[model samples]
Target chain A: MKISKEEVHYIAKLAKLHLTEEEADKMTEDFEKILSNFDAIRGVDVEGIMGETFKTTEAPHLRKDEERVFEDKKKLFQNTLDLKEGYIKVPKIIE
Target chain B: MTITIDAIKSAIEGGERLTEEIILQFYKRIEEREPEVNGFLTLCRDEALERARSIDQKRKKGEKLGRLAGVPVAIKDNISTDGMKTTCASRMLEDYIPPYDATVIKKLWDEDAIIIGKTNMDEFAMGSSNENSAFKVTSNPWDTKRVPGGSSGGSAAVVAAEMSVMSLGSDTGGSIRQPAAFCGVVGLKPTYGLVSRFGLIAFASSLDQIGPITRTVKDSAISLEVLQGHDPMDSTSYKGEASSYLESLEKGVKGLRMAVPKEFFHTKGLDPEIADSIRASIERYERLGAIVEEVSLPLMEESLAAYYLISSAEASSNLARFDGVRYGYRTKEYEKIEELMEKSRSEAFGKEVKRRIMMGTYALSSGYYDAYYNKAQKLRKIISLQYQEIFKDYDLIISPTTPILPFLKGEKTNDPLEMYLGDIYTININLAELPALSMPCGFSKEGLPIGLQLIGNHYSEATLLRAAHQLEQEIGLKSPIRKEEV
Candidate 1:
């Protein structure tokens, strides 16, 4: 469970984060200690238990898929840092 | 010494427009103690005063007010407030004013509850101690040196210090109850899905539940009446008739079968005094005519590990939304889009939040998913099944709300694992999605409070409230330290 700097960077990259050397080193140690603490889960004998995705007794009820519009689209659009027309503006992801 | 909601309610009922008077009374206390306590991040002074004055003017017009008329309530920073900043105690959302209010906030406004302010908390509700809050540390009201256990420390401390009549807090692995216990208030983590979670900043979505932190057990019951019910916005929110919690609260605990989970007593960090206090609460229940029995939840130890894995894994995905594109902090120096997101998140999220996202990212990574995340999921079922079996025969379960008393600020901050263990007795209830409550049962020799956690089966809040109400009468801990006491 000893996390290397490379592994920490890889995980951080996957999480869409960049880290300073100090934070990366600190996180490397943290991941090791936390993951070691989590080893206790491996000791439990839960051989055949079925996973309950959401634990509520009632199943998740989804609203009917309809073309309903939001009354506050302008308000919702206002939170974005950059807006073009009614949509959020982000830096181009593709060439 | 009691600060019940009834005082404000009764005054307004008698046609006295005391909204300004009540808000100002609590406002005076906040001005006095807030610097020492460090409870609130943003005080809604002008807005709250305006809202309270309007309510008073309406009262003069004989307009009917909602159940909570002009009583100010503190909100933990994570829950969304439309015009006010809901930072979740992180720099990322430091000035992020949500477009709409959380369902709970809207409900409170409807009832004419004055919005006291947004209180400080562990950033993203990530830490056990309030120290993780990027803004400030909320101290235990009883002993200013000690922490008001988090991640809802601010909410609990405000209620304990009588800054607000009641407050709202979201619990993900003991956020609400542990703070309530540490600060000597009644905090409830209601049944999962009982209260809607439309606008709560996500922290382990499945385990995250919003509940009240109040000065009294009955007030906790009364607040739940306003907080629960169906929400079309939240698909997970329940659509069933929940019991009338306030009415059923007066039902005595006679003939009720209560279980004291045997495993919780021997939890590694269990302080001797906390154990003794919880045991005494159980004995008192017996003397009051409820049958108390000791039961074992064999998967108790494993539940903590599962909680971290599942919560962290979920947090990894949920928190990915904080990328600089839409709202929150964005990096100014990044040249590329990916670089912008990466640097923005890295610079914005605190150490603990980063650690969780990294751990979660690792857990959900290609090779580790089955061994870590999926295994935790399987183990969750085993833990829930154990509680389900025990609940069929027992009316309720009880345990020490936290393994240890409120430690001094910065005591466990350096060691995240040590901080994580503080929720040993409280995390599994969230994992099992059961409703539970914590109330001040006793005090440590130093006078820092000890809380007794009363747990109930799913949607059994009425029964849990009844037992808590009965215990409140029996124990009668001096709650809501008055302005003079401070």
Candidate 2:
């Protein structure tokens, strides 16, 4: 249950979060406390129970696939933080 | 005038009051009380007034309006509304206005319901109290220093304060019920998939449900009737005929079997007064001819562990979309793309949110998925099966909604363990995907409200509402005494 500084860094990298040394040290303690709490569940026996996904009595409804026309292009860009040539701009994935 | 949904609807139809006048009243209340309560994140003054004026015109012209016509309603900040900023109480999405309205919001609009405003919540619905919100903490109308529970704190606070007639709140691990309990209002977390999740900002997709928080049980039922239904857009929505929850409100508990979990009653740290109130409620139910029995949920203790694992893992994935590149707050002065993402997320998200995301990432990592995430999923099944077995013998399970009444703000802010324990009685219901309702049953010695939770079988909201309504009538729990005049 102990989260080392290295493990905190690893988690941060995976989550795409950049933490300072002080933040990492603080998170290490928080993570340790949370993980230790979760460790309490290990003693419980849960054999032969199938994992349930979404709960519903009926099957999911499928809509007929059809081409739908877009009515509002200006509205789509109303909330965009960055836009260029009528398209949302993002950090370049490929350069 | 009564602020309940049924009363408002009756008044509007009877021509006793116009929709415009109702909206004006709500605006005045908000203007007077919001400085102290911090209930709403976005108040739709112009749009709400316009809609209300239109409804008034229709009434004057003798045209029929929709069921919820002129009924002012508040929406949780996480639900998307077209052209309005849907912050989810996070700085990362502070400027992110959704291009499309959430399915529930659209339905409310179609029903001619006036969208009064968007209420505050835990940032990304992550915390137990409203303290984690980036904007401001929502104060309980009952006591200004105490927190209205979260992440639906603002929604419940608004309903309690009479700032809005009814408000929508999304429950993931008792977000709606806990807050409603704290604020002394009625809150419902419908059976998972009973309501559509389309356009709801994803937190834990499998567990999250949008429900109603209102001043009365009947108002909660009427709001649920408008909100619940199948939507083809959301894969998890239930495909069945929708029932009128309000119509089933008067189906009194003549032969209903209620189960009180011995484990829930024996839990340590439960307030003695809260326990006494719940016991009193059980006595009332017995007087009403309902059979009450003690039941044990053997797997209940492990629910919090499983909930943390599953919810964090899903949240890490769901919140991954909030990169600086998308339609949200982005950091400046980053040299590389990696630095850009890292800096933006770390700077924008709160401490609790970051900690959870990191924990989730580790749980879902290649080396530990089986030990943490997968094991939690298997434990979830066991918990659900336990409920299924118990439901065969009883129609509903009853418990104190929360162990403690609403604590003063910052009381448990530094102690994460203490905060997580706030959800002890409620998280198990969400894990089992069962419908549940929280209603004010009694008042604490300190005058704070105590709520009794009624957990029901899947799609058994009608029975749950009926039981809660009957108990509400018998006990006559008064509304949380407001600190500030509305």
Candidate 3:
């Protein structure tokens, strides 16, 4: 499969990466080769097999929802680099 | 003192060596070799010494000591250790310290194993060579200019350099085995869910498994004994009785049926010397009274493709947590949330990581999801079912752990596809979710080590180790040259 530059740009945008033109060109070649190799899977016949999403034997046991609050939010917030008013601050999404 | 885990354990138990002394020796080795090899990301010197001294005190009091008590083990940087910098060899987590230990780390501490340091890895375990690490490239101890195959390169290099008795490494595809093969050490990637993944920084979660990199198969088995079992914290952990991996070491492969898939051997781009060495190892097994045969796995060729698609898709989602919002590095300047995520990821993650994330995001995107992600998952099931059928006919399968020997640093960095090809022979085992061990079988003319891989049925780590240990004796290859030579 030939990967177009526009497709590469879209992928980079979705992945939150700002790739230079040189990087995108290189990635195009890599993506093409990797996709070609994967084309071998197209020949395999898997009609009735069920999809194995996660390697779990049974459904995950969910803990009952409770209104427990963390007493020490300080440690949790310690690693955050940007904060304002006890909440993690990020670049404004609003225009 | 010898740095193998078994030797260190014996010396400590025999009253001839103190834990403090062994810990000091490892520190000295690190001080001497780490500058050239770039093995460790963070050295826990004071803490290791303190733990060692406590173990010595326990010995003096004649208290019961754990099997691996006092042994210094290096952990791959991705596994979390409380109060220690678990960077995953990426700039994103450079200053972040985990408040709790990973389940594997807690298990090792409970077994009395002292953590000497956290080792380097490919940033987020994305690349095949250690050169992708944001910290530094880990050189093969056998040859300084070449790579210690990655992303678990640092863990394998420490064992090869005698800086640590044993090390823990994670294998998503061929991270653990490829490095162990390159460095001429024993690496075991146990069956998925056999060892808990709790505390391992997620990278392709369904495929990721933590296992041992050691000098000998017995040592690998012993380490697995401590690392395996159910963990309530990791929901994917196996819920069955854990076997004594060490107890079955002496059991020979008398009647075991070993298979060699013809496709694995006859594949293109395989080095001639590596193929011959693997063939010779198979002969040795046949001589040991095991029935060897060639089995057909037509679906094996598609495994690498399916693996990359599934793994990349999962990695994109898994790494989404590092958006500079919760923890780790955050961009100081940005105009919007989208800009913050873009700039932070681009600045903190390496090129290879970004490439994979981009590929994964594309694979999982709206129009392409069916053609890429869904198809890959269906292919994964076919490949797995093929293994189930093969296992019914064969007790184990043997092949070259890696198709090629260690290459010089930067050899394939620009050519990502070439780098991915290095993992061709071993990734299938992970795709099938089976246990596999990579051990030194022979050496290249350049004197670089070549490894033979043994893939086993589910939970058949004991039998796999027995075959590998038997071949280890038969081949009698010298350990990788000391770090000073390179």
Which is the leading candidate under DockQ? 1
Each candidate's number of clashing pairs is 0, 0, 0
Model 1, B73-116: lDDT tens digits are 99999999997888999989987989889999999999989998
Candidates 1 and 3: which is better by lDDT? 1
* DockQ of the two-chain complex in candidate 3: 0.56
Stretches of candidate 3 exceeding 4 Å from the true structure:
A53-74, B482-486
Clashing pairs in 1: none
lDDT of 3 by residue, A9-34 (tens): 88888888888899888888888888
Interface RMSD of each: 1.6, 2.2, 2.3
Docking class of 1: medium
DockQ of candidate 2 is 0.59
Clashing pairs in 3: none
The sequence of per-residue lDDT tens digits that candidate 2 reaches over residues B1-486 is 446766777788899988888788889878888888999999989999999989988888988888788888999999999888899999998888888989999889888899988999999998888999999999999899999999999999999988888899999999999999999999999998899999999999888999999888888888888999889888879987898877778878999999998998788799999999999999999999999999887655578989989999999999899878756778877767777888889889998899889888999999889778878988887788788889989999999999998999999998777798889988888887889999999998888998999999999889999999999989875754343322
Residue B48 of model 2: what lDDT?
A: 92
